[model samples]
Target: MNEGDERALKVAVLGCGAVGSQVVRLLTEQRDDLAARVGAPVELVGVAVRRLDAPREVDVPAGLLTTDATELVSRGDVDVVVEVIGGIEPARSLILAALDNGASVVTANKALLAEDGPTLFEAAAKAERDLYYEAAVAGAIPILRPLRESLAGDRVTRVLGIVNGTTNFILDRMDTSGAGFSEALEEAQELGYAEADPTADVEGFDAAAKAAILASLAFHSRVTASDVHREGISEVTAADVASARDMGSVVKLLAICELRPGPDGQDQVAARVHPAMIPRSHPLASVHEAYNAVFVESEAAGQLMFYGPGAGGAPTASAVLGDLVTVARNRLDGTRGAGESAYADRAVQPMGETRTRYHVAIDVDDRAGVLAAVANAFADHDVSIQTVRQEGRGADAQLVVVSHSAPDSALSATVEQLREMDIVREVTSVMRVEGDAE
Candidate 1:
């Protein structure tokens, strides 16, 4: 091999799936540009797959393809290992081994990172290697680096984002087409935005994983996937969309992470992923289809947003390549990148401690004083209604009240009081309203 190729940083791609193929394709196609940028050529040393006989997309040599992922990761020739085989199993194990064997790592597996980030990060730190995963969250949007580097000196108070393209596409279609949940999901699957078994995407699991990562980075604390309270878009109906539209708003799945004061005068972080009502004028409401946007509210920077394609082979590959370049530079310099933040390891506040506005739809007796009674219930709990709308007069009337920012305890008490009222039939929906006009 030539001196340029010999000294080039060698990368092994584990899992030649949809995302892995793109990584290989880019490394080959953009070799000249990447080499110029890095001041040295980067080479793809090997490609690992579950099946050696699987049809491939890239023009990689068959000899370079192998089913031995463990062997590939531990090879001494591999300088950096990119793990795209998502999940908690062999991906996690292989990543740990890659770092143990003195190789840097770039991963697109959000699930693995969300679950075992602390362990893996510690492993890399011990090895004095870089473990970068910008592709793991908000694909191609360049979120993690900004949170880790650009905004590292600033204090971020809140991060509310539309991080999942699949659910965002489904919700956007439902709002515009007035389609029910199932119909919108069906269309999303057909259009390749969602998988056939889309439980992970539609059920808010995917967004929750991203939320955990964002929360941890923004707060400089450790937040796990289990710490987030997740609610899916499965229950959103056409009626819900119409209700939001009537109020000049739209429905979107939001991953929200905020650091607020607790009772002890200390900072407490709250992380959650759920479907909520966002005003039509909000920036995120305009984000449609398989795109991602993260709105950050910082104490110093005020309001800022990062938006782009959140997923896809090329978009994801772009993020991986960026990390690869940075890590390669750090490796050559004999220095490691920034490690996890152990500063301000604040408590993850319970869901009940998270205070926000609420929109409640209740089926009430269409009588004259029913509205007054409902309003009194909210007043009893010290929750003030920002707006109230009553529809369908007579015995089948429904009372919809949107409350201003209030304590979660008070909101829960108001709901309980409404449930106890004899005139109230059922609570149709009770959703949090975020991104209110400031």
Candidate 2:
């Protein structure tokens, strides 16, 4: 090969699964356009998968497929490695090796990134290679790059999102049709929204992972999956949805990340994922069924939202290809992209220290004074009521109380006080209320 041909960038793909197949297809289909845009032709050196015999959607030469991911990434010819494998062990190890071998990396593994991103980012920084994962959080939404590049100069205060499609689909079905949780989940599974196992999506684990990544990027601090307070959609019953409708709201699985003040006057960040009651007027409430939306609040840019399909083979592949093009351009220019930020280095606050509003639904004896007793609990905890609705009097009365802005500690204490009252039969639901307009 001539010097010009030999210097062309070589790319290796790790994992040829659904998303990976689409990446390969796009690379081949859009080769001409991509070459023209990047100023140099990009070539696919090899693809690594667990089984070479497994059928693939993309047509590649047989010799280029390999079972050894380590060898493919460490190969001298590969200049960029795109990892689409969704796991922790070999993916992490292979990414580190690729960076060490003087190659940049782009991945779509949110689980691995949310768990051990800082470690891998540190390694990439040490090696001075670009590490991009635009596909990890909200697939095809272009959220990460906007926050990292476009809004880098602005001060971001909060990022609230409906990041998971499966949970959102199920919740939307329940709200619109009054379907039970199990029925909605079954329908989602039938339509491929919910996985067969469905633990990660329904239990809020997936949203929590995305929340940690967003909080870390928005606040310029380090936050992990363990730091997020998670509440899944499994416990969100039909009754809860009904209560939300009565109160002019809808239930959504929200991943909320905010930067607030700590006790010592320093910035404290809180990242949590839970099923919350969003007002009907909120923009996110209008987002329905398998669609994702992220609302960002910044000092300079003001309020901005990015909305689109959060997951799927084609959507995720679009993000990966975009990153691949950017990485290739950076490589041709002999430059590295921005690494992870530890700018503010703010501490992550405990859940109890975060302040918000709550909606508490209680089943009490059909008596006049029961409402007074519930109001007293709020007053005792120093949580003022924003709205109160009581209905179905006689034997089984239900009272719904929505609180004004209150400390997380006070909300918890108020719940405890209501639970201990003699007139209160049971606390049907206690959900956090968010996205109140400033």
Regions of model 1 farther than 4 Å from truth: 1-6
The alpha-carbon deviation from the true structure for residue 270 of candidate 2, after best TM-score superposition, in angstroms, is 1.0
C-alpha displacement of 198 in model 2, angstroms? 0.7
lDDT of 2 by residue, 1-438 (tens): 232343678999998988999998998899889888877888888999899889888787888899989989998668799999988989999999999998999999888989999989999999889999999998999999998999999999999999999999999999999999999999999999889999999999999999999998998888889989998999999999998898789999999999978999888998889999998999999999999999999999999999999999899999999999999888887788999997788999988888889999898998767778889999998889998988787777888889998789999999998999999889999999987732
Top candidate, metric lDDT: 2
* 126: Cα error in model 2, Å: 1.3
TM-score of 2: 0.97
Question: lDDT score of model 1?
Answer: 0.90
Report the C-alpha lDDT of model 1 over 48-115, residue by residue, as the tens digit: 99888888776778878998999999988788999998999999999999999989999999998899
